[model samples]
Target chain A: MGEFEIFGMPVSLGTMIFQAVIFTALIWILKQKFLSKLVGAMESRRESIDNQLNLAETYKHEAEEELLKQREMTEKATQEAKQIIAKAREEANIIVKAARKEAFTIRTEAYENERRALKGRGAS
Target chain B: MHATRPLVQIFGLTFDLSIIITSTIAALVVLVFAYACTRHITAKKPGKMQNLLEWVIEFVQNIMVNSMGRKDNLFILAGGVGLILYLFIANIMGVPFSFIAGADHATWWKSPTADAHVTMTLAIMMIVYTHFIHIRLHGLKNYFLSFFKPFKALFAINILEQFCTTLTLGLRLFGNIYAGEVMLGILAAAAMKGFQSGIFIGIGSSMLAAIPMMIWQVFCLFIGAIQAYIFVTLFMVYIGQRVNEATT
Candidate 1:
């Protein structure tokens, strides 16, 4: 109490201590009811804001991933279709070439036969 | 002429009932501002009360964070808006409770802050709490040893600074409030003779009394708020200096 009294006042140290003790009690009570609640609300608000931001970021990334996947699938399907079409075109070319060759040979042979028959008839 | 009559007998000590009564009123005013306004506070949708509460919290939080970083959340919360409200109410108590109910001027219901005991108590508490915070931030051994600092010569000065802080903080507030209230009392005393008569001289004296009292009351508002801010900010700053690595 002596240490607490500094520059000395009209009132007793006991009275000052009593007042301070009352004030401390009030501080504790106010802490429980007021300060803690407001701080909690602020903290909760900050956390919710962070959560919303993170959620938005995740949604954006997920959307980009979905877009990339769709593009890859479409690209793969286009390449497969092109490969099939090219293979079918090559097969058609081979078949058409063989058919043309066979027709030409048959025509040539018939022409030759017809010429030979004409020659025979003329010779006869 | 300073005197207080006992309003009630509490234990063996004679209590100054006016201080209790006036202080109770001030405390209630603060309580309403603190709790009633902030009741049903929300994180998302804030009402006007919440807005005010948030503003005050942000203001105090900014001061605390500027001193010590955000890591000291416990300290911040503990030294938050409550102290400001209490001290502001305490400081301005002279305005609301200036009326003397009794025959004698000795027994008036002015602010408890006008009383040195109350202010000194708060100062002593500040001293105790400042040391407590220093120890809490830096352990006991380190806090005690740090008083020696770069050299042993500063040891006495460091110890004396704590006492000086308590005295200065307490007396500064007490002096301001006590002096202000005393001046108001003088004004009131001067005006008593004016209203007693119906003459032109009385009217002139009454006008003289009216101007200073009104002006001082308005000024009282500013002084009260500024003193409260200074007191709380100084406490935080002192603690900050103690806990700060640079100051140590």
Candidate 2:
């Protein structure tokens, strides 16, 4: 080692170089094999989570819109049903009034004709 | 203690074989651990190892984001994970057992991080990489101008600070791990001395030393993890300084 010493410890260039190489190799191998895989997995998982969240948000919005449309349709149908019932009641009242007037007229005419016939027989 | 490590001359450079071996062992252990923790990684249903690995990655991500403000730097994130894993594993490698062999009692096994060479090399590598990143991010001219930032009078201080950063970053880890191992060695020697003196005294003193040793080992584990976190965090902070300097 040619008497190289630092702080009472022998310093060797070979050992330093060897260790540096080992450390570099360690970093390269780990980066290539393990860290990349883990990071990739994490990234994909995050992307999927984001995608699912976005999908849920859109679905919720669509469901709300559909519920609103169904409510409006039900309201319109109820209003139309009320209008039809009111028109049917008005038509039934008019028909019953006309029928009662016609029956009263017919009874009056029959009574008058019978009285006139009795008077003629007495005169004869 | 041996004055020199077992040296193997190769191509005019003297290599410390023990550091090489222990470091290789530490590196292999890290590799195996990484594989074990990541073998069955599932995005949906993660296993225990997967969960731990994910947690570590997330932790590193949080550190980077905290420092750099959500900048997308995958390379740095990967390096951060590698750094923390390797450092934590290497720092604790000497806690369980140490191996010394031959007549000179050459150390065959220990934490590679306990040695100044490995730690300094790591520190240098990180600093150099940081500079490279700085240059790549802000151009060479900007990086050069950064040394004189806010005024021209502080250039020397800025230059000195870089050296200080490297030294402190390396030596802090070395100092902690080395102290830990030195104390462990002392305790082990005391225990051995107890066993050598007599059976009853050996049992008593050995038991006495065992408590401290166990406690030190646990403390070393905590130190290892903390040091790893600090090292990686500081490295990120340095990178963050470079990356966010333009914006700030």
Candidate 3:
């Protein structure tokens, strides 16, 4: 015989069909059990990555807020420094004016006293 | 010469040794390269091999999203990758040694896809899986209604479309690859016949003809890969449509 026959059917045909069935079964099992687990792992990995992205986003927002706060603080500090400088200038100006007025008064009193003493000596 | 026998039999099944060896070596090379590429994957910056692999992954992803939409059927992405890898390896099985690899073999296990049994099995799986997805997504009532047309006269046409989709998917791949193998075999036979006459003339002609055939084979390899991709993409689209209809 060319090949074994079963019920006048060639064994090769039966073998091919059997192999196909087995292969199909193998793929089905892989898809059901193994592939499901693989998909679960993939999904978990995706979730982790997404969670990291969210954390990064939160960090970015916090950084932006911190930067804004720093800017506002710097601006406030600069404004305070300007006000203090202006106040100090005003105080220095007041002190200098008072000292100049006192000096003028002292010089005038000394001149008057000297004139008075000269007049008494001349009389003597 | 027995030691250099071309055929090997296992479990009453015969296979061409040259084809088996060549395909195994090719598969090993691809597997090793794929593993090596996987090891170097980094989110920051990717090397050349990593970039190439990522590009392929993204390309397949694009195809999946386009065909299936970016919804619940993302699981099909893995299937698409498997299809592409298997088809690519099987297509390039005949590349080395002047297309004298699995394509030239005349036994089981030669070009795993060239065999009708293998292709039909894949087709059956895809078709059955699609139907299973459909039934699972949409209960039996709506899924069966997909076959019924607006008019009763068109019911047969609608049913025919489903059958044709499965039939064409299997036949198209088989037809393309089988024809390619046949062409390569004919060319190899002609070259051999010419070689028997004289070395100088035979070598010159065969080399001249081989250059174009080699180029064509390369093109065929790409076509084979594309056909495989198209098949799976269509399968995903079918499933996606069913899921969409069910949701709506």
Query: What does candidate 2 score on TM?
Result: 0.81
lDDT, residue B215, candidate 2: 98
Model 2 clash pairs are: none
> Candidate 1: which pairs clash?
none
Stretches of candidate 3 off by over 4 Å are: A1-69, A79-124, B1-61, B70-77, B97-110, B139-146, B241-248
Candidate 1 wrong stretches, greater than 4 Å: A1-9, A53-124, B1-14, B197-200, B245-247
Residues B108-136, model 2: lDDT tens digits: 78999999889999999999998999999
Provide the lowest-lDDT 10-residue window in model 3 chain A.
A9-18
Model 3, C-alpha of B146: deviation from truth (Å):
4.4
Which regions in candidate 2 have their CA more than 4 angstroms from the true location? A6-9, A60-124, B1-4
Report lDDT (CA) for all predictions.
0.75, 0.88, 0.63
Global lDDT of model 2:
0.88
Highest TM-score: give the candidate number.
Answer: 2
At residue A89, give the lDDT of candidate 1. Answer: 100
Provide the DockQ value for model 3.
0.09
Ranking by TM-score: 2, 1, 3
* Model 3 C-alpha lDDT per residue in residues B1-248, reported as the tens digit of each score: 00122454556664445444544454455455556655644554457876665565567678767866773343565565555665566655654433333443433333545544445556767777788888887778877886764667788998888788777777777777767766765666667777888998789769867977787788778777877777767767776676677555
Cα lDDT, model 3, residue A75 = 100
TM-score of chain B of 3: 0.76
